[model samples]
Target: MTAVVSLVEHAPARAFPLPDTVGRALAASKILEEAAPDSYERGMWRLRAGSKVGVVAVAVPGGETVTVRITPKVPVARLFFLLGYSSDPAGWRDGMVDVAEHSELLPALAHAVERQTDRALRRGLLQGYRTVEEASLVVRGRIREAEQIRRRFGMPLPAEVAYDEFTTDIAENRILRAAVDRLLILPGVPQTVRTRLMRQRARLADITPLVRGQVIPAWRPTRLNTRYHQALHLAQVVLDGASAENLPGGLRMDGFLFDMNRVYEDFVCAALREALRPYGGRSALQAKDVHLDECDSVRLRPDFVWYADSGTPRIVADAKYKAGKRRGYPNEDLYQMLAYCTAFGLPEGHLVYAKGSAPHTSHRVRRAGTVLHQHALDLDRQPEALLAEIRELTRRMVAGVKGRI
Candidate 1:
């Protein structure tokens, strides 16, 4: 059950130096801090540290007096807290090799996706997709498969198989190189990580628990030896269908963003499709790059769009990658979402931001005589918990809009 929050209300309790989750984790981890809390609650939560190096500040009454604040040193558990991975997997970390990975998009493009993927994956498989159009998922699947083999196997084959034998395996598509390359090209797959994962997989697979020199994984039998086992399950499914016939996959996935946008008539709704699922909604990614005057023209791309279960109301939300400062919301963001809500004929809209900042705050704005909300998704939260938060917010927003009308 969720506590209903009114856009009209505000919290006057000042704030704290730490996020509640981080504060709790610190206590649970039970590690003594090297020092005391640099930050205590002042009129504004103050810390004498971050962003730009040199000391800079003076605080007065207005929000105009911005102070340079310090970012606290990240505790060990906090890293896992943000990435949605298991922090204390017990021995799993030892078994789970930290595969050096990278995304293939330019920084701006990739960051745009961070929140999109975060939302969709959290929401559930495809609950966020507007339609089952085509997707380049086949490409992703194919590459993931080859890479898994390499992770399981590895390159520079244990002096057991010579370079010639390895080349033959890769050339014959035993590991499938073309699919690997295509996977790397996915709009969001990181290239550098793909490179390292691929190299490691190829070099390591040839001499594990097999014969006098016949590496057992050569045939890749199922086994349970971290010292010798491989993570090929997902990759294998990918390889199962990698033909011209499968090329239709990317189109469906690619169009998913579009369907979500149309379903609710939201603006350039730029979503990863996965993040919208938990809310029983769909998402899309949009752009105004089509026209040149678009420089001044706002290319407002939203992340998630919702159509009511009874199909009466629709909502649009754009997920922001960064947290906001205490004073107010990012004007550019508010402007963009405003455009989305206006274009979609929606009375309300949302701007959802990642929530790993010192203190997370939700800002509810009144735009065009309707309430527009900015939500903060806690990066430190468990995946299921985050999904629930988004779901409840959607339900409330729809109902709120109806009440306003």
Candidate 2:
């Protein structure tokens, strides 16, 4: 049995009692903290869902019958879809159908993993052997009997061989297999999905179990490796959500935290760059075009910079994941954009917000020629519609630039 705790977005903290075994797990994981002196429960947790929505789980002890589940008020499917954009924008559509059909985050993730694994299996897992040089009777690469003799004389024979061979037990396969293994144990995973995941894991028998804190090796992009990239990416996301701890049992997860702020920023920047391709202008993310001070010690990094044909900064844009005009557009953001415009010698800048009362608005500096345009994206909308909105914004940016030119 699991303890399902419902928390309203940005609401006051709520208390819940846990079994001693489970309580120990939560404390070790820090998923829940002690409430004030007045509250009687073992721990209190508050959910700050803000404008983004999704589900994350807390792992408990073996004997304990309680599990902590945090559910967001927003549609879980939509949230997962938006979250997917953070990791993959171009290929997100590849998983949206399954994402919208699943009600929980973990299942949706499972579906993604299964599909990617199937695709990878069809294409064939990349093979590359990690090199090893050892003293052996059989000669593989070369013999270093002299060094072996220097260190210690072998009783029978002495030879050192360094070689590389083909293997299916690479990091890519191990990571995918590990994620599948973890999902199989998670509650609320669909039986059908579990069956599919089990099959996928079986195919990766040669790969070793990914130990906790093991660094996944990076793979180069080739025809063989490219097919595994998306699958590997999704696997990494699932693996990162699971944290290991020393508690009543060997290791268990506390939960996963998805930072919607970073997700929105990455999506917006990537979408804008793609949208601007038709206009023949290049968009640079985290463009370091300006230094705030004379010493160049302090520098300004605008989220995006659109460069004109002549190789000059035409426009700058920033992504903000907040609500309404009051909270979304702050003095700090305005000041930062003003600095970007002044430094780049541009008269216009763009700010993309998560949600706003109006679709668009413009702000002009009190004593300057710069104008900041604010735009909003409703995350609840379909993924395709969201991309279309970005495309429209790009058109507006291009038109504005042309008029000035």
Candidate 3:
């Protein structure tokens, strides 16, 4: 049966009937829970990401199943860049090409996979085998083994010799093969792409199957091997959670999921850093050990903290992934931001939320000498426009700080 797959970002719940097998997979992944208890034919599921991003598949043996690729709601190109950024703080964009027109996550993933594979192939599969030293009667690596065995053993007719040699179990080949093997099982990968991957995999015929949790060797940097860096990282990301389940009917596999909170927070903090760079201030993310109480026990970790050159806190900003329209901002969020401003002795704090009905709003704390600015960023906007909004916010924040100074 054809798979029923849906690509969705972190959003509202989606309902669909799921077979017991597929339901179990989703449940294990914590992506969904049964909406209605009674009927096996009726089930509900939604995207639940806990600090991860990418494609993850859900399937059932010999039955219809759904493969949901949880990704960012932003434009496909931006999302790709963001994913690339999340993996590495720098240098992830080197091999990535322009792919904004591709909307869905699967196609984008396939495109990346194909491109990376081709790049790795062009660089030549980093092929250096490990030494496999063993004692044998038959001649192998060198006659030194036979001489050693002859000296050790009294029976000289059939000499037991120690031989030193290497096997075909290579690091680069294994990683590439693992990636290709994973792509082949991923449900929505096109036939052409799969064929390409297969060809790549076949070239690494001597490579042993990469065992789960096996440590992939980190190759040293060199001019010739630099091209393999991005592909190796991609291969690792694709093969990290690659799994296949053998059941009574058939085999099923799983894919990837990402946390929207992390994505939003990272994007905002990174953009804010770039936006604030020219202003000559310090920006720290996940600032640590902020005491909320005099006891030094209660602490708060604000997402981003901008400090003036004088070492005074200017803007304490937090990124909220939820929409304000849906149930509005939590009272705790306000209290937390307020405490951030108060603790830092700042006149105002900032809360950046994803797009909502109210794009920008502010709240003044009466008699508290503190104000809270809430700004919403539309992640769906063009990359330049999105960063521009962040820059505008930074300017206002800097101006607000300068006014007080």
Candidate 4:
């Protein structure tokens, strides 16, 4: 039977095994020395080390392979550059400069900046649809305040102050703006089902609690949900008040900002799958989310399952949010891939982690009379160089599965 080798990059890098990806990245770095003298000039390895990053690159056989280049695939450099933390000058760009001070404000500012500047404009077409109504309420409040209250408070309030007022508006708008343009702001739907606000509103049939009762009570909202909801709500307001073409773009950016985060997993999975495809395999098998059936032993669902021309499980890849291997591969992962490997009784199973600061590759655990190979996959290299290493790793994985290497 032919061999089908596959690599899966860690999408949510932290969820998977970080060390494994780092190991793979480092493993590839070791082979960089062998890259054709000048075939691929620039080669390097950037591993995670706590708060900061550790980047080390080797000059190809020739001089100065690459001065410096920024890549979307490499999250570490982008994160550093976005935060005005790049070690070199060339890595800095207009957007990074444009967002320099503000970049440090957002928690995942680097990823957000990338999405705003580099990612597709329509990348998240349906995201706004998820909270369309809530978005409408939030934005509506802001538009109203910018038109109404901000000026009513004398001068335009500081953006920070406006932000707080906007929160107050969305959470308690139904009560606050009673005579909004003679529209009679009748008490209506609470905008979401999670809230028991409606039950509270049901009791207050008299004057209706706007500023004092509802809005004031919401002052110290507990979880981040209210904030997220307000953000979503504000988004819709902007959508409605804004022009048509930019509406879609704005929605996509907001959604991408909320959902798509650049982590080591995204990097690792990209490399892994890229390696496997050319050799008769599929990299990402968005196979339906596996639901663990705890009937007898354990059954699993794998995000991606690959096979060579010979119909054998070549690689079982999953992305974890945390570093290191957990107790039992999250039960579902174990059983799903076990069924994948055992169904065909393949030789090995591989679990890839998002590369982290730890520094070692992965471990081999023996279970059910089979060898499960867990490894760290890294994501610190030139795009082309990284792809080449993926190809080689694919070859090695396939050969190992076939007992040929």
lDDT of each: 0.35, 0.69, 0.67, 0.34
| Model 3 Cα lDDT, one tens digit per residue, 52-111 | 445655555545656655555666676665556555544654337444345666556766
Model 4 ranges with Cα > 4 A deviation: 1-267, 289-299, 310-312, 325-340, 357-368, 379-389
Q: Give the TM-score of each candidate.
A: 0.35, 0.79, 0.72, 0.35
Stretches of candidate 1 above 4 Å error? 1-281, 287-299, 307-313, 356-367, 401-405
The worst-scoring run of ten residues by lDDT in candidate 4 lies at 251-260
Candidate 2 Cα errors over 4 Å, as ranges: 8-66, 72-97, 122-137, 142-161, 185-188, 225-229, 245-253, 288-290, 325-328
Question: After best superposition, candidate 4 residue 333: deviation in angstroms?
Answer: 7.3
| Model 3 regions lying over 4 Å from their true place | 2-7, 10-14, 24-28, 33-56, 59-66, 69-72, 85-102, 125-178, 202-210, 215-253, 309-311, 326-331
Q: Point out the higher-scoring one by lDDT: 1 or 2.
A: 2
**Which tens-of-lDDT digit does each residue in 210-274 have in candidate 2?**
77677766655466677787788778777766654555554355444445566678788888988
The residue-by-residue lDDT of candidate 1 on 1-405, one tens digit each, is: 111111100112223344333233323321211212335442222122111111112222222222221222222132222221221112223213222232211211222223222232232222111112122323221233354345536443222211112122321122223323323333334555455445533533441221222211223322322221122222221232221111121211110010111222221122223334545643334432222233546444455556555554376667665335656557787777766766667777777665533343344455356456766655455444644565565566656656765
**Highest-scoring model, lDDT:** 2
**Global CA lDDT computed for model 1:** 0.35
Q: List clashing residue pairs in candidate 2.
A: none
